[model samples]
Target: MKNLVNFKVAVKTRECLVQAIYQMLFNNDSVAKVIDQFKDEHKTKKVDFKMFSMSLRSINRNKKKIESILTSLEIKNSSMELIDKSILFFAINEMLFGNLDKPVAIDESLRLSKKFSSPESYKFINVSLDKFFKTLS
Candidate 1:
């Protein structure tokens, strides 16, 4: 179905978004550099490139606001893995700025954490982002 196809691309985009964020942290690359690298790497994939680029740009643009929220939650950067931190940043950015529903953002973040992070990281991500999500209401 068309919906299934769209869902795949959306999932791929979210995966890429989290990776891109991780790269920004892990590689110490500038947003512009990461964007360019991701574009080149995913040029032939079935990624929703527009959404990936927009979400990354938005996440980069709103870094300060996102950090402020995380600070309020007392989420210390060193305490979490880079992947978990990236997932939180992506989820919080989506919940705050992207068009997706908060639940979608949270669910996508959990999915990513389960796929790429430690077995127990999703629980931490869920609780932390849920706390952040509640503040938006």
Candidate 2:
């Protein structure tokens, strides 16, 4: 994984990552198109493109595992909205596969939930991650 915090960088790196994941979720375009569209639509002038790119790659590689974790956490795909599902994908990928810290993953997921999902959906994000991580221990 890329060292996003190693040197001077934009603070919205995490946001851009989440946005890329959300784009992958909602848009029917290919990953390349979604990334290009995200960058073009958001006017991401200073965003860390590596962060978004690596996150999308990780999410795509472990997509089945991420979705399986979600199912084990009882977040049924049929019951959840697209935004919440996207949050799960991003957070789980970070927690399980990416190089980010666990708390950072949870916190960023909550932030994304607040921004893109229902207010109360953050609780589900928190609880699900907690449960999933606990099982790993």
Candidate 3:
């Protein structure tokens, strides 16, 4: 029997995306390895796999560029918690390169931070992403 949980595809996809990125940061796993890892997890089966894969692939392909862009925000990711950095990287990449709208990317980033990071980390994520957007306008 399969255990199924009810989660919106977008929400679950982003949740897994953050975790996959965090895992990659720590383990330095290739995108294929990480996607295979997620695919092997029954708990993650409900995610929007296309969204998750495309986002992860885009990030993988463009992570350095995205990192440079976010680095320009002066957040000093070198000192950031890995989870926080992962969340910022995940959301900002989605905002700039993926199909999600900017607001949705940001909102989902905050939500992911709240779920997986320090209690106050979401606030920092919010301010950082906001600053990134301000520079764009």
Candidate 4:
């Protein structure tokens, strides 16, 4: 059932779901703290803890890949804020791991930026994801 939920999210709204996960990770104050809190809070439940753990590990393991994608797109150290990095990470996760269609990934990134980030930030995300998509082809 948990796998079914993940599969549905991955198939139907992969980019948005990855963006949500990245947002959770990036804004958690600290990854370790977040994990600790999650463990403490959810340990009593009979939820799919293993899948959640795998998702967290996958995010952590792909951090460098995410950063590399942003750097390749010239996001720039000076311009890359936490939110910007989170967008990049989510985009890369969708592109590399989530099985989302390319245009869907790009469009969803743009939409997420427009909804959650500043106007200027949306432009940055648009250009970056556009460039990243071009490289994939």
Which candidate number has the best TM-score? 1
Model 2 residue pairs with clashes: none
> What lDDT tens digits, residue by residue, belong to model 4 across residues 10-127?
4333333344455565575454554566667656654444444555556677877876777777778676666666666777776887656778767767766766678888888888
Q: Write the per-residue lDDT of candidate 3 for residues 1-137, one digit (tens) a residue.
A: 11224446777788889999999999999999999889789453568777788889998999898888877887786689999999988988877887878887788788888889999998999999999878767
lDDT of each model, Cα atoms only?
A: 0.88, 0.77, 0.84, 0.64
- Model 4 clashing residue pairs (backbone): none
lDDT of 2 at 103: 84
* Regions of candidate 3 where Cα sits further than 4 Å from its true position: 1-7
Better of 1 and 3 by TM-score: 1
Write model 1 residue lDDT over 52-123, tens digit each, in one string.
889898988998888788889989987879999899999988888899899988988888999999999999
How much does candidate 1 score in TM-score?
A: 0.92
Candidate number of the best lDDT: 1
Instruction: Give the worst 10-residue stretch by lDDT in candidate 2.
Output: 1-10
Give per-residue CA lDDT, model 2, range 1-137, as digits (tens).
34546633444766676667777777655678877876787664666777777888889889888888888877778888887788788878888888878888887778778887888999988888889878777
Question: How many clashes in each candidate?
Answer: 0, 0, 0, 0
Q: What 10-residue stretch in candidate 1 is worst by lDDT?
A: 1-10
